[model samples]
Target: MTETSPRPLRVLAAMSGGVDSAVAAARAAEAGHDVTGVHLALSANPQSFRTGARGCCTVEDSRDARRAADVIGIPFYVWDLAERFREDVVEDFVAEYEAGRTPNPCLRCNEKIKFAALLDKALALGFDAVCTGHYAKVVTLPDGSRELHRASDTAKDQSYVLGVLDERQLAHAMFPLGDTLTTKDEIRAEAERRGLAVAKKPDSHDICFIADGDTQGFLAARLGRAEGDIVDEAGNRLGGHDGAYGFTIGQRKGLRIGHPAPDGKPRYVLDISPVDNTVTVGPAEALDVTALTAIRPRWCGRAPEGPGTYTAQLRAHGGETEVTAALEGDELRVAFTEPVRGVAPGQAIVLYDGTRVVGSATIATTTRRDRTTAPTA
Candidate 1:
């Protein structure tokens, strides 16, 4: 019997027209893979217009990605996934807001579009893997199974956003940036060495769909404005607002309440009741959240053998706090070791065991365990 050598892998690099993705595609090709660079046109007008040297997903970004592909000597193409993006990300964001929730659109995009839709299509075309520039390490356990870990560059680690990928998607994932311990500056330097035009391009921040950073205006434009009441925890009307969905938990600005608190203390948004069209405001102490119930829990690899404890992060960049989390039917009941603040529903709660990502879910409700503390204001 004749033994044949392993064939070169066919990798489809999803370039976002950034230096990180450009270098990722280059590295994949450099590693003897049959690499192809594909740019995902996420919106209709993807022109990179910079307010002050920061932009993303623009037309120039696409061209920059093509130029990088040209320099890397790989075939490149643009795939129009705008409609899918709107259905999967933008609409989901509006719906979440309509339901009085603060949603993370990036996490949804990674879960539904990149790893799910893009990966499914890539595999249909016989591609071995989908490559990207995300800064999160993917490790193969000694048992021959894969696991996701935080990047060596903690400051730029993107494991929080990548937490949505399940074991199936992780099997076909290739993050070239994850393998590096270097800073983003070093990645750009490598791009410069490789003659990639996006070497000096500014990294895009904020929501890509909202060209203007006015999330309130953006939501109002879609959901429309309606008169609502701003009430205190006791359900006493304090002020009137144009819309209730425009406000978020922990927001202290734009309350526009003419009457000051009886104690002359500032208050923060404690909750949003979309059903009643009321925005609940309370003192700062009321914002302490000690327990949160998250639903739709997804494990990166396997479900915890028997949930005891884990560290939970409420935001993409927020610090992880020790918590006791356990699966209860379809939901996750998490009890923080101390207390956290600003936890809003529909936002993801990424769970980690040390540096390795374990699971994540969308926050459904919050329980303020410190409510016993008297209102000092």
Candidate 2:
């Protein structure tokens, strides 16, 4: 083998039945790995999942994955993780929202299902690594320590969502598409050249379980509607709401207040109190958060020694902001260099050191620029 040749090993490629995963599996097989394909059945009733390009893990996706595996000359199987998905991702999403905090189901799915459960099964079955189409790179140092980094294609980089992966998961992960600097169009062309049927399949979006993409409706259906008060920061009742879980911090629209603020400025959701079932709306300036306290930090390699400056990404698709962070026992306290608007609890805060992912933690509390802290619940 050449110096650049990958060592032959047992590789489990998770085929999501899309252009990216299909191409990734093919590339892994082409690189001299002994590959097998597997598609995760996340929903018990596959028909209830999203169709076309709006979602994944549906019956349609399973069939597409099987075909791609056949084309790649690898064995394929579908693993039923429906119950696990419900308990971990779906239930956790509802629980977080019910507690007046916004949760990212995609991040939870990546952390719980793809990395934890699926990777654990693969490792137990004697697989050397779990391969995926995620647009992020895993670099191994000379000492064999692995580091997660952003993909070459910054536009399609997925390092933020994958930040929840710790050192153990990183060691047995393979991302075949991370080194490609070409555009998605080029990837489609490659798929076409390779005779893959999903060459033009559109990418999945939104939460996969919620087929209709109506998150508020989904939550309402599960948690039932409870009338609540929408109040201003001063405790003035501005309006009524069906449920406090329907609103998130920094939300300015769908408030249905009937009347504008006293200064004619738009009001944004600043706080959500599950205890009192109140959604606090205030001026946009009141939403600026200067510091936050996060819990359950997961590092890609070793934990940071003490207080250090790093760029923190509040959301999966959002940009990074400079922050000074320190670990105090079980919590991670981060002080942002500049105030950021719209941060909510239950969301994951991914820390990055330049292009490398450092770690991630769930936002438990946020301190506003005025030195007032929101309730941890």
Candidate 3:
């Protein structure tokens, strides 16, 4: 008696026109799966900016994806997801910033637009699973639960942005490049060997919506700039700013203030009060925080029922720190094992268990336990 071979799966590979995604499709085809390449048209303003090889959903990118699909000998199509992308991703990004919270657009895109909406569409069209080039992996456990894990390539690990996915989504997703590859360079080298057009393309950077790194200008254009006061910790006016939306926590440059600290020390923006139209500057130490609160949390799978210690990353590419987390109603309270500097209120706090992503939430506020005043009778 001989062991039976597994049947080939029907896979829909999302082609971003990057070397990684192109190679992902090629790998899927090589694995003997029925692969269909899809390029999602995510932007309505296709001509607003030059469609560089790095950016996604551009005209040139779509063409590159089609060429790759042709080379891989897979059925390819371009789906117009611009409306959904605007609603689920762009709107959420603007709303979060307007509410004085920093939001990760990529996380929102993965949660609301890509894995959920796009995956559903693929399944509806009779695909077994959707695949992408994300530097992460989906594992099936012995007990029949699906788990999300970091890719074999630690340097390109994208588990932070993908921490919001639920178990069902994880079960239906595929990362073809998860186990075999490590670096972008290696992936590109494979693509070149395969004669794929996107092999030499550069990776996209910054927010996809913003053509350049112009968050302040983008916000001002949308919300309208208003004159505001820049003050010190003691409420003494130092200078003026265009608006509170122009600043972010931990920023040092672009402050047009002329004031030097009385002690000849460097001053940092401590707080931004949108209500009072004020930006406060103080010593760098004022930025240290020990605890933070996050709202509207989404776990990679179901989160643990109670408080536990986990590693949390504050920014996209930042270092992870140990923290104790607890759920309070819909909010999460994260007490860091050590003090973290510049824990901005509007950023993301992604939780991880070893190499596996646990969940993520937007920071609502941060408090320094060492600096808090004691309660009095």
lDDT of 1 by residue, 1-377 (tens): 00011456889999888888899889888878899999888886665233343434677777878888999999999988888999999999999999999999989999999999899999999998899888887887667577888887888889999998888888788887776878778898999999988899888788888877889989999999888999998999999998888999999999998888888988899999899899999888888887889999899999886667888888888998999998988989999998778999999999999998998999999998555563422
Candidate 2 least-lDDT 10 residues: 368-377
1-377, model 2: which lDDT tens digit per residue?
11123579788999999999999899989988999999999998988888875428888999999998998899999999999999999999999999999999998998999999999999999998889989999998878788999998988999999999999999889899899999999999999999899999999988888889899999999999989999998899999999999999999999999898999988899999989889999888888888999999999999999899999999878998999999999999999998898899999999989999999999999988763454321
How close to the true structure is residue 253 of candidate 2, measured as C-alpha lDDT?
Answer: 90
Which residue pairs show collisions in model 1?
A: 46-58, 46-59, 47-59
Q: What's the best-to-worst order under lDDT? A: 2, 1, 3
lDDT per residue (tens digit) for residues 1-377 in model 3: 00011567788899988888888789878888899999998888865534567648778888999999999999999998999999998888776666656678888888888898889998899987788888788877767677888788878888888888888888778887778655677788899899997888989878777776688887888888879898887899899988787877767788788967888877787887778878888777778787999987987777779999999998878888999999989999999887778777768898889988888888988986445462211
| Number of the top lDDT candidate | 2
TM-score of each: 0.94, 0.96, 0.94
Cα lDDT, all candidates: 0.85, 0.90, 0.81
Superposed model 2: Cα runs more than 4 Å off: 1-5, 371-377
Model 3, position 345, has a per-residue lDDT of: 79
TM-score ranking from best candidate downward: 2, 1, 3
Q: Is candidate 1 or candidate 2 better by TM-score?
A: 2
Which 10 residues in a row give candidate 1 its minimum summed lDDT? Answer: 1-10
**Evaluation by lDDT, superior candidate among 1 and 2:** 2
TM-score of 2: 0.96
